[model samples]
Target: MEKKKLNHYDVAEVIDRFEINKVFDCFTLKNWLAIGTTNKLKPSHSEVLEEARQQLSIKWDEWNEEELKMNFVSMVIFVSQLDVPKHINTYFERKLSGKVNEISISVTVDCMLASPTYSGRPKNPYFFLQEFKRSLGDNHDPEGQMLAAMILSQKLNEDNEPLYGSWIQGRFWYFTTLTNKDYCVSKPFDATEPEDLLQIVYVLRKLKELILARVTP
Candidate 1:
């Protein structure tokens, strides 16, 4: 008999299997984003974000998954600037797996931040983002996928710190965090809006700072 794969599970199934509790308008997520920075965006990053907002305003509903990734998502990531001096860099289309007692979860993450040991391999994943153009026609569970990635990253890190992740639905992005069995999701941040897009970049930047603290001596 073969083991169960994560992609086959829906968000509810993943929650039930892991005994995880979901909180809407989660306080933890709200606080996480709040601690993000008060400094104004650099001119270069501001330009990048403005571009992404403009593009999403026009193409939010028009883009397919690939186009959303290449056009809209790329701009947000560019503004976030996850690459750090500590070698905690970003990787794409990576596989993550972990076992919890008798159950196991495996997922191919769309985008992740991890410290690479070799040239192309992610050694310790800290953050993740799973995305799709739209939820209806695709018939895929991006939340479940993102949850699985966060679980594995938590296990691999073996650190008590909360794990962070996000899942994109068309032009909206939902930030998530897992601490023990509590899974919290922030309200969707609309990429087409200037203010929400800035907040998205701020959260990403805050995440990088958190990861650096864990990895740095």
Candidate 2:
């Protein structure tokens, strides 16, 4: 028999197989968003966010994953100062183990913002951004893929800290968190909205602060 090709949905199914306790039963969604706010972006951060918002307004639907990521999303991340401790790019494949099937899983993220270790490799992944084209229709599962990446990062996290992630399809951005096997996803925050864009930037800034605190000497 041929070996199966696993997509993100398969990975999610595998995660579902684990007997993890969900915290939503214990805590409200509002409390989750407030999990950590070590730092927030200043008003200056809005300058770049406005630029990205304008660029995305006209070009969002026209670009593919790379184009959207590089031209808009990456730009926003850079402006938000999330890339302070480490640079950002693609082409790295992360291999992970699944608890459900006891098989190896591999995934490549579109853009990963991480803190570098002493050797200068991506040591702690602070935030991940994934792109799923609306053009792909029902075939693409951006949320599933983001969840899978979070799951993989959770496994890689020596401290078992909560992982942060987001996915973009068209102009909408959806954020999520994975902690202690419990997953909590936020509602769609349209990139076109000024407040929504600011929130996204704020989250990135917070992640940067969190990473810096952990990695900085």
Best by TM-score: 1
| TM-score to true structure, per model | 0.90, 0.75
**On a 0 to 100 scale, what is the lDDT of residue 135 in model 2?**
48
lDDT of each: 0.80, 0.63
lDDT of 1 by residue, 9-122 (tens): 477878887788887656657767885347478998898778778887988888888888888787778878889855688887888877864568878788998888866578
C-alpha lDDT (0 to 100) for residue 85 of candidate 1 = 51
Model 2 accuracy (lDDT, Cα): 0.63
| Alpha-carbon shift of residue 36 in model 2 (angstroms) | 11
**Lowest summed lDDT window (length 10), candidate 1:** 131-140
After superposition, which runs of candidate 2 have C-alpha atoms over 4 Å from their true positions? 1-15, 18-45, 86-101, 132-139, 214-217
**Over all chains combined, what TM-score does candidate 2 have?**
0.75
Q: For residues 104-215, write the lDDT of model 2, one tens digit per residue.
A: 4566666676656666666656566775453444545776666666666666766777677778888888777777777666788888888788777766666665666666
